[model samples]
Target chain A: MKKLLDDPAQAVTDSLRGFGLAHADQISVHTEPNFVTRAGGTPAGQVAVISGGGSGHEPLHAGFVGAGMLDAAVPGEVFTSPTPDQVLAAVQAADAGAGVLLIVKNYTGDVLNFETAAELAEAEGIEVASVLVNDDVAVEDSLYTAGRRGVAGTLVVEKVAGAAAARGASLAEVAALAERVVAGVRSMGVALTACTVPHVGRPSFDLADDEVEIGIGIHGEPGRQRVQAAGASDITRRLVDSVLDDIDLAAGARVLLFVNGMGGTPASELYVVYGVARQMLADQGVEVVRSLVGSYVTSLEMQGVSVTVAVLDDELLELWDAPVRTPALTW
Target chain B: MKKLLDDPAQAVTDSLRGFGLAHADQISVHTEPNFVTRAGGTPAGQVAVISGGGSGHEPLHAGFVGAGMLDAAVPGEVFTSPTPDQVLAAVQAADAGAGVLLIVKNYTGDVLNFETAAELAEAEGIEVASVLVNDDVAVEDSLYTAGRRGVAGTLVVEKVAGAAAARGASLAEVAALAERVVAGVRSMGVALTACTVPHVGRPSFDLADDEVEIGIGIHGEPGRQRVQAAGASDITRRLVDSVLDDIDLAAGARVLLFVNGMGGTPASELYVVYGVARQMLADQGVEVVRSLVGSYVTSLEMQGVSVTVAVLDDELLELWDAPVRTPALTW
Candidate 1:
């Protein structure tokens, strides 16, 4: 594999070391039991928000750790769930007097691990609440997930929930806000190429040159269908249709349309997909009031795109627009 | 070629439409002699700062058009320079009562076309000054350039110069600042795979499975060497050595170290490269006071990375820290 890595075994630790160094003013990295917490520990009397998953899909949990987003992020090995101890460490390090909220993606491993961590934290007399994110409309169950897998919409959940916490919401309020975002958001992805995990030293799947996978999961799990490669608009239509069909929106509903790159796709292509998806929503009389277009969440270097539609009310819009500063996201 | 594109011919236009739509609050796209201008137009007395080049590099010229950045940006066809007419249109649209400054990369076509546009703008009674950026240390001359090719360091020039213009510096002052940045900055890149132009229907260059092209140009041009693939640390060391060797920096020099991904690389890998590069600089007694790590400048889905080091004074540091709000970058 032609990846820029030192020992594949040391990939996560080394990358985290670099991440911490690059954003030293914003975050502090903890080894031994790997986790990252905001440089200035969580403030007193404010709910602490945290999230994590596999390592390859970067700028997700860890990159979002800062003043207005995640208070801490626990990172597992590439494409593997973080252990219970790792998550527990993050919780202990981040919790202030206001308590803590864990935003767990809906994968089976992630769910079980974060649950264990929450229990562990509670045993230590720390108040903890967990909200599961299952926003992907692509598949009901996949390789690592027993339900709709959390995908790009995880970013929306973290941002809105983090903003609520930053605004001094209680633990219950933050957890509820996260679940609200999970309910309002839906995402679907397509993969043009499979990504190679460094340790595996090969692509997760073999896709024919003229083929594309629709409704693919973030970890290269099988999608809903495999089909012939088509034009950008045709591919985009499939994703937009799946997401729009899953969400119940009225003619005047307002939303945030996010076009995310799977990884290797260029920004120009992401914008093209964004334009097509925006127009499709407009045709359905749904107004796209807020938009995000970039590769905030990705599967290593997979070349594809995911379209996320989040039904937004005034409250959600205000939270999204709230000032945020993180390595991966800021406003 | 597997790419997210409609007709290859419409790639630039379609993408620009989406960009303008996505950032309507920040920029306005103009066609028929296409260019992008600040949404509110350049301030009445602030010298207008503008930059442009071939289109595949998204978030470069176009993405940086905002309040604290470029007043306008001209984009050309993929891998081709913008026409003189296109540059002239941007100059006309962005010129405030003060003047306009064009930041041109050192590529021959960009230099010639921008020169013609400056002349045309001057003939129309608008003041114009041009700054040429040639920061790539990979080579002295190549297929598309007469001197060292400008690469990621172009970002350093545009950002610092744009900030100066935003602060109401005169055209001369902005141009001089841009030149100062060009003189202090140096960059070098390595590509693991060649990027295919959409219309080309094939990779720009072929490489064996275990080989890498060192010091490759953004356009897939020949570089300093092609060698067997190596670990991230070794590759980063080579790039750092070349950049540090080309520039004379004594102990205790303060610099901004930017590690930019060439589109297809992941953030994790970029950070891996960043960590190694930063450590090497520290070993040499050069302190990295400011850091930028991402795909701000890129080739079209080229799987590679570039390292840029720009010496900074207090003035440049202040300008770099100045608030910038754009689609691709914000602070």
Candidate 2:
């Protein structure tokens, strides 16, 4: 596979080294255990928010670490879950005596590892709470996940919960807010091309040029269906319909519509998808109160897009609108 | 070619529709003589900063069209220059009583059209100044440009100039600052794969599986040479060396090192490149006081990157740090 990397085994470490250097003012990277923490450490007596998973979906856990977001982010090798020790270290480093909140995606490996880490942190006399995010509406079970996979909607969970934590909420309050977000958010994706894992040096799956996978997962897992390639509007309609049908939103429900690009898609195409999706929601009488369109959570240069809709209450909207300062996301 | 588009011809218009819808709070979209302007129009007596070019390199012209940046941006068809009429319309819409400044990339079509637009605005009794950006250090001449082709460094110019204009700099002062940026900045890129323009339906150039083009232009124009694929460090070293060599920098020079991803490359790869480039600069005694990473300027899903080094004086540094609130960039 053609990739800009050195030793395939060193991809994660090398990239993290660079990441720490480029964003030194915002975060500090810890080796050995491998976790990134806020530069000045978590504020005293503030509930620390932490998240992690595989490394490929960049700007996800790591990029979101800063003032109003993750206090620490632990990254595993590309497409592989971080070890329990890594997560425990992140928890220890981030806890500032107010406790910690862990946002774990529903993947089996991630859930187990983070749970183990939480247990380990609790044993050390530190308060800890864990919330599972399973927002993907595509499938009931996947190769790597037992429940619905956590795709782009993980971003919504992190953003809302991070805001709560940043405002000095307790661990229980932040955990409750995260669970509320998980209940309100839903996501679905389509892949035009598969991404290759650096170590494997081959595409994770094979997709014919004239076909597209609908409801695809971030790790190239099997999706709900595969169909002949179609135009943007038709493809977008399928995604929007599936997501809306699954969510129990009423006619006047207000929501945040996020159109996220899976690595390789350009901003122009993302905008096109956003316009089509926005109109589709409006036709259903759903008011799109806030919008996010960009490549935030991705699948290692995979050419695709994911549509996420999160029902926004007044409190949720306030949290979403709260100021956030991070490397990948800032306002 | 696999792309997220409908009728290839509608790519620009459709994408703009989505962009306008997604960012209605920040900017307004105008059709017929298509252009994008700040939502509330330019502030009276404030010098208007405007820029435009082909459509493919997104977030360059349009994404930078909010507060503290461009007052207006015009987009042409993919890889094609904006017509003189379109540029004229943008200038007219963005101009307040303080006149306007046009930032043009050093391309044959872009230069001619923007110049024509300036003359047209002058005929209408509006003061206008133009600055040409030719920062690419790849070749003295290229297929679409008479001299060096403008590449990623155009961002530095627009950002610095836009900040000046926002701070109420005169038309002449903004123009002069833009020119100074042009003189101090230099950039070079490497393309791992070619991109397919929507209407063209074919890769811009051909390359073997194990080949890479060094010193490449944004439009897939031939670069300095094609060599066997190498690891990230080797490739990044070549790019950093070429840019530093072209610009005359002393040992203690302070610069802004920008590592921009061509659309298809992932963030992981970009930081790898940034880390390498930053170290190389440090080894040469040049301090990277500021950094901007990610895909700001892109060549429609091309998998590659460009390194931009701009000498920053106290004034330029202050301007670079000025608040900018656009869709793609905000602080």
Candidate 1: segments with Cα more than 4 A from true spot: none
User: How much is B201 displaced in model 2, in angstroms?
Assistant: 0.9
Query: Which regions of candidate 2 deviate over 4 angstroms?
Result: none
Individual DockQ of the candidates?
A: 0.86, 0.84
Task: Return the interface RMSD of the candidates, in order shown, one decimal each.
Answer: 0.5, 0.7
The complex in candidate 1 yields a DockQ of 0.86
DockQ of candidate model 2: 0.84
Residue B258 CA displacement from its true place in model 1, Å: 0.2
The digit string of per-residue lDDT tens for model 2 on B1-331 reads: 8888899999999999999999999999999977999999998899999999999998788999999988999999998999999999999999998999899889999999999999999999999999899999999989999999988888888899889988989999999999999999999999999999999999999989999999889989999999999999999999999998889999999999999999999999999899999999999999999998899999999999999999999999999999999998898
- Give each candidate's fraction of reference contacts reproduced: 0.71, 0.71
lDDT of 2 by residue, A101-208 (tens): 999888999999999999999999999999898989899999999989988999999999889988988889999999999999999999999999999999999999
Clash counts for the predictions, in order: 0, 0
